[model samples]
Target chain A: MNWDYLLSLFMGGLTRGSIYALIALGYTMVYGIITLINFAHGEIYMIGAFTALIAIGVLTLAGWNGTAILLIAAVAAVVYAAAYGWTLERIAYRPLRHAPRLSALISAIGMSLFLQNYVRMAQTANFLPFPNLIPEFAFLKPVAHIVRSSELVIYAVTALVMLLLTLLVRFTRMGKAMRATAQDRDMAMLSGVDVDRVISLTFVIGSAIAATGGVLIASHIGQINFYIGFLAGIKAFVAAVLGGIGSLPGAVLGGLVLGWTESFFTGYVSSDYEDVFAFLFLVGILIFRPSGLLGRKQMEKV
Target chain B: MKAEFKKSLLAALWFMFLTFPITVVRVNTIERTVAWRWERLIWIGAATFILSFIWRRLLHRKQTGRREVSAGEVRPPSRWKQMAADPRLKGLALSAAALCFLVIPLLFSWNKTILVTNALIYVVIALGLNIVVGLAGQLVLGYVAFFAVGAYSYALLNYHFAVGFWAALPMGAALAAAFGLLLGFPVLRLRGDYLAIVTLGFGEIIRIVLENWNALSFGPSGIDNIPPPGFFGLALTLRQTHIAIYYLMVALTLLTILVVHRLQHSRIGRSWEALREDETAAQAMGIDTTGAKLSAFALGACWAGMAGVVFAAKQKFINPGNFTIWESILVLCIVVLGGMGSIAGVVLAALVLVILPEALRVFADYRWLLFGALLVLMMVFRPGGLVNARRRAYAFEPSAPEKSERP
Candidate 1:
């Protein structure tokens, strides 16, 4: 047991988990409401990364520095990505709402393909470098030696986002509408909850959060590409499932656990088997608790 | 006429805009972002406009007034239906199809013969998948895993033990069946999306194993110089080999159709249909849900394995890349697009999916994009598929209804 090695892996896992948690939050929220996997969610994330790259490039020309530039770029990315998410829902999903679940899933998959190729065609298939924008934090050296400023930024941003999301869901009228709609669409409609608006809002918010994750991940990885969103999206979806899909806390927990599992597996076992192990874990979870770690066991209505 | 043209123009522009985000290239490596190709958009728009008018006049006129019967309903007799109803006409049509298929290579060049051969292979794959997803109502996302397993089994047996194609054929299928059982047991409780993902995971695991286990699979480089199957004891030249494989694929495809058609009429077939319709009701009526599910899995795997052996034999090489999720997605698309549980639909879909893409040639770069978009569009417009399988209109009634009626 190398304490130093373990500590580094743990820190690395935490940052990775934060990214997964961001993406998982979107997956869980959308799934909770409509029960569609939103296969395009990953592509949305990639688009976010690309948008951020373009934004940073423009901002850099405008001679902005440090946190101010990062903030503006991040906001720009989130807004653009939220718009993409909303459009996708409107075009691909809303039309197929009354259709079979398989239809929506297929639509999502199509949207994903469309978006991935769209980006690949628009942006170079080659990896574009993302700017490092986080300011140095001089005070964290004593508390955790392995923690870097950018990583610390990721942790803080993710925590802040989650807190804000929790507040939004708990306190806001729209949040209440979303929760009500998720609970029972018919009943919610009867109660004057605009289920349609709530679903759209869910997509909007989820995409925004996923965008934020995309920015952070791009910064962390120091590069962005068309293909980045897929594997990350899948792992995050698995995490969302692991935590019990449709549960916010479950998604976060699952993301963290999945991140840690990969890190530890990579550290202790063969690195080549990381994805294999993650997939196996997903299979195990599916076999044992199909509802997931915290998912409500659904009853088949006669 | 103007309205239709306007509609076509709008559709074309929409497609252009949809392709815009992916089509416009931006590279910042050395601060250069140039979007190449403006004329392609014009080509697309022009093509769509021209084709839309032709299709509207030629094809849409005939189908414009046909009643859209839901799946499982017995459609009213049409020209095709009337022709199909006559045994003499049906036999003649079948003979014509067989004859056409046989003479296709002779009429076309060698490239087309190979393409048709590949299309024939896809038909076999689609038919096998139809058994699980279409007939059994189980969506197995990792269906390609079985196909890959079959190919590997054939390849490895031949490579390691000098086992010829004849011996390896059954061996490959059996091994694939054994794997299907192994993977199917744990997922018996799962349904729909859950079953899909687990199967997908199972497929990925198998792929990873094949990729990593260098000694067995030769890793990513793939095994080459694989011996093609012989005609009993006769050796074949390259040209003759292509013809032999083509006919071999034809025989196998026909064999698959016969087996599947027969199975659909058997006692077990009825059980699968019941299981597919409503698992809970089927179980309540003592349908042995797990047994039906496993059998479907096994049988589907068996066919996929046989296809795999044929594919390996034809290619004379095997690689892990040949067995990717794309392959699974392709087969699944065929089953879904063709109309689940419709044998003729699967055959039609297999031809359309394989032949159209291969024939187009230029759209090869956008293959997955085209496939994915078509899948989504198909689902949206025709959820039941191109030829939706009707509810069992010719099958056994469960004893419950009969017992209640008697009482």
Candidate 2:
């Protein structure tokens, strides 16, 4: 049994899962509150990566060093992504709050398309090379074959983000408001919670996390284009659904499960049908457990 | 008005900030070059400034219109609605539209004929999708998979066994229906959003399989040189063939419209409508919700299959690229923008969406961007779509005042 090969695949899955979890967090959080799938969430991630690239390019031209450029670019990505998310909710989604569920979904889809084209038109359609910002660490030379230094960073950052998010959701006054809104929006509004503000904040927080993931993944993958968000968004959404969409832990677990499944399948089986396998897994999960693994079974109110 | 101007100004400024990174900075990492596009910033600022004012005005008007309605103000019927209600005008409009359809193709060049023919094909496909989404209320994101199935079935069968178009049409449709049932059966139990994702997944699976499974699908380069439908085995020239396809599409489109109209009035159609409104209520009313949903999928898939076969014949080639999720979205946009469940609306939308792009080739780059914006704006401002399907009205007359009964 090739233990080393298995270990490498495991690490690969972990890295991939971390990225998925970051994006899925946004989808789950937004869906938890509004019950509207923010289709443009993926586009926010794309925008983040593009923003980071632009920042890096400008900083490099200004003769900045590596670490400072990375830091500023990441910050720029997060801020811009959060802004885009907040604005998107206001423009495309807010007016449709009183409308039918399908209307919001369509609008979300439209926003996604619009954003994708906006990037394509503003930038280039060809793949832009994402610079690898994370340097190789000399300390883990022996186990370097199993896991790259960047993968370790991704895991650590994802863990830290999750911990921070959990703390925010559990302890803060705003967190309490968000919880109330998610539980029952009308009740929350009546109880003096600003529902609109809470919803916008959720989008902001989600988009910020997704941007972090976008920046990290783009660096890892070494290339990005206008269309990366669509597939990634779909996969992340799938992971969120697998985890039982409204549940944060469920999203993380789902991401890990999906990432592992994809990595192992591609590692062992033919890589040609990797996407097919992921999609089939989604279908199977949806068919068997519609509410998801961690999602509570919602009662149909009479 | 002053407040509105201030808001628009704020919006314009916000847009300028939002667009700074993408619009202002162009980075080519491979060449290590940074191109600063300052003009784009100006363009964004200008566009947003003007658009914001228009947007605010429309929103204000919409709000006022809603307020008037809520306040019990009796608004007169719109001119279009009144014209539609008048039999004389309706007949005149119908005949004029028919005359245009008949005369325009003959006057058009081969490219124009092909474009119109494609539009006609979409009209059929859109009507099919209307059955599932508009009528049955199931959002199948992978609707294009069935279309692909039909196309591939025809393509492969013709390539292997020399099966002609006439022989392949029914076979293609049946195969597509089978595939629809295959997808619909498992997903029947899921809710709307979940169903959408699963269908999307199913679509990707189909595409990936087609692209990878070289032994079966010819692997992405696609099947080509597939002959157009034979007119008694006569070798028609390219222009003649295109004209034939156009006429064929016209005939098929008419058939689809007639069938869809009939279905909309049928018992099954009512069940679909009921299912769409509220599944639980529909089920409580003894409508087999499952059956209705499944039938919608099968029937919708059947039409897509027919259209797919025709699409293959028209193009004389079949590839995975022709049946992407975007194609499904395009058909969906027609069903939606035209007004769900409205046969005439679907036809009109299909014509406009398909033909408008070809007609306005200069705005090709901004097409998808505008489409996305249009979808959002439509949802925000006009959720009922361009033409709301007229609801059935029945008048209840009180024959006489029952004074004795009241006493």
Backbone collisions counted per model: 6, 0
TM-score of each: 0.89, 0.97
lDDT, candidate 2, at B337? 92
Tell me the TM-score of model 2.
0.97
- Across B1-407, the per-residue lDDT of candidate 1 in tens digits comes to 78998877876776565443334334354654434466766776777677656645643543442334433466567897677668899789889988999898799988889889999989998998899988888888899999999999988888889999989888888988998999889999987766776787788888988898888789988989889998877777898899989988999999999999999878888889888778999999989999999999999998899889989998998889999887898898888889988888999999988988777878776777777777776775666788877554565657775567664
Overall lDDT per candidate, in order of appearance: 0.84, 0.90
Candidate 2 segments exceeding 4 Å error: B233-235, B396-407
How much is B388 displaced in model 1, in angstroms? Answer: 3.0
DockQ for every model comes to: 0.46, 0.82
In angstroms, how far off is B26's CA in candidate 2?
A: 0.3
Error of 1 at A104 (Å): 3.0
